[model samples]
Target: MRGQTQTASAGGRWRGDGAAAWCWWWVAVVLLLGHLPSCARAGLLESNPGLAYNFYKNSCPSVDSIVRSVTWAQVAANPALPARLLRLHFHDCFVKGCDASILLDTAQSEKTAAPNLSVGGYEVIDAIKAQLERACPGVVSCADIVALAARDAVSYQFKASLWQVETGRRDGTVSLASNTGALPSPFAGFAGLLQSFSDRGLNLTDLVALSGAHTIGVASCSSVTPRLYQGNASSVDPLLDSAYARTLMSSCPNPSPASATVALDGGTPFRFDSGYYTRVQQRQGTLASDAALAQNAAAAQMVADLTNPIKFYAAFSMSMKKMGRVDVLTGANGQIRKQCRQVNTS
Candidate 1:
């Protein structure tokens, strides 16, 4: 099995011996996570999340249920809301910590950035914030709302949620479009993805796992076209499945100005399942970033483990918990805003 190639059609899946390597480490991952509390394992305790899991228990008892209920209803209505909210969280965390900076509406806020133009669900975050204000005004932070709403969006729809967000994050007073360059690009390769994750103090495990969030989101046609036609079959990255490339080209033959979108996962685009990893393993990944997971030894090995729906679901939960902790604001650092789109009157 060492150095052997196995095509998905052959039922072996994942080229080389990655599958064999994946089998051994899969158990260790599960066992390691099972024994470690989420805070320690996700590194929330070390890099971020100075607050406790019960931070809002006494101050705002209904915060959890209210956010989940509102997010679930919105997702049920649109089905695409989860992915949008998830992207919002990623964009927020990548810039200025997870301080709700992405939610600001200033003339030069992160939302106005070129990379963040497609990110939506401002209304969802606002609605959740409004509900929280009525229930416990001036208590809950807008930053925490983004985190909770992201968790609820994916968990409620797919039942694949794994971690609870620790609260006490504050709203950042600054939001700049320039900060977005650190965020991962849809066209990034394996090295680019690694650096992007590493910039946020995340490791390869977090990169592979959190990337599964693409399982439920949509990518614009512009992002997809470059992957399909930038090069010929030989010149293009061999990781992409040929038939799948042809299929993608058919959907996005020409770049139109009207604005179009397609699911990042392509297979089970609306569900938060292990399908994304499998698609990546089979070279059917829709984005350059999605398909790049197989290019690295470490990431590909994890991809092999995550091919199983159960394993992928568990691993994804762990990674997401860690991703939410990237560069957070705790202690007396930031402020809670009355509205998510603006900082409180200081």
Candidate 2:
């Protein structure tokens, strides 16, 4: 994939297709609720409060729980680190809408590669884990800690109540550097992203839902400026907003990879919704991968469907559950490491 293009050939280790249960259930719910108002369809958990609690209990932890587990004063004592962690929610939310793996050095698998612990977030997770170890001992899983930290990070930044996720996930002992390749590149187009998600057994709807993470976080100028400067005929695609495009490119001239890019949701970058879809329709999408989503037939329709906030919310929730299930190193495959950044020296 290059400038103004996308590809899906970078395949990961293929996982089995057992997610069909979740996929089918997701489809049935959407089809049945398709006729209702978006908000009506969205009150899924509100209708069944226990289901919401169950989802959290089965999936991951919440922000408030993790804060209670660790000392923020201790975290802040390390000057360079706190600010780095403040960016954690931003990084994860920007890509996959607050998935914990955003802080996972997915690249930690290779024997020769030094652990590329993601900035300070992973370190923060470890610090919190230590505090939890003293109080709860082995009770809290590192995975849960990271998951809750990420949720708390998002809730804090957005000043919104985050959905509670289930905890009790164990820490991953092995960190694979090659796994970093699995993270979608901003330069990638439609094909690359689809293949990546598909290799993980994610389908088209899952792809669109996962991409909703873009509703939060800032994009760099290098990612979006090309759509404005490159005169690629694809730029004229009606999905893009001309005024928004112009405004984005104005201060972004001679775009450095460091220059700021606008948020997909012109309004709220924190709360999740279909704003990303709207941005794409206006030609304001920030990445070739993002724009390519609108270019494809199946993906584009999902984007269009998302214009209905209720449909988008339900799908977004389901898709998130699906994304959370991808390629997890569970059972005997990988051990839960005490430290995410390093393999056990013993």
- In terms of TM-score, the best-performing candidate is 1
> Number of clashing residue pairs in every model?
0, 32
After superposition, candidate 1 runs with Cα above 4 Å error: 1-33, 37-48, 158-161, 231-237
Against the hidden reference, what TM-scores do the models get? 0.86, 0.63
Q: Pairs clashing in candidate 1?
A: none
- Candidate closest to the true structure, highest lDDT: 1
Candidate 1 CA-lDDT value? 0.78
The per-residue C-alpha lDDT of model 2 at residue 240 equals 51
lDDT of 2: 0.51
Compose the digit string of candidate 2's lDDT tens values, residues 1-346.
Answer: 1111111111211112225323533554565355346635556333321112333332323334545435344332332232344344333322322334444444434222322232345666777766655544434445445555644453332233233444334444443445445555666778888887776666788888767766655555665666666664235324456776666666466544453545555554433446778877666676667787888998888888886656665665565444444444333443345455444355
Looking at model 1, report the run of 10 residues with the lowest lDDT sum: 1-10
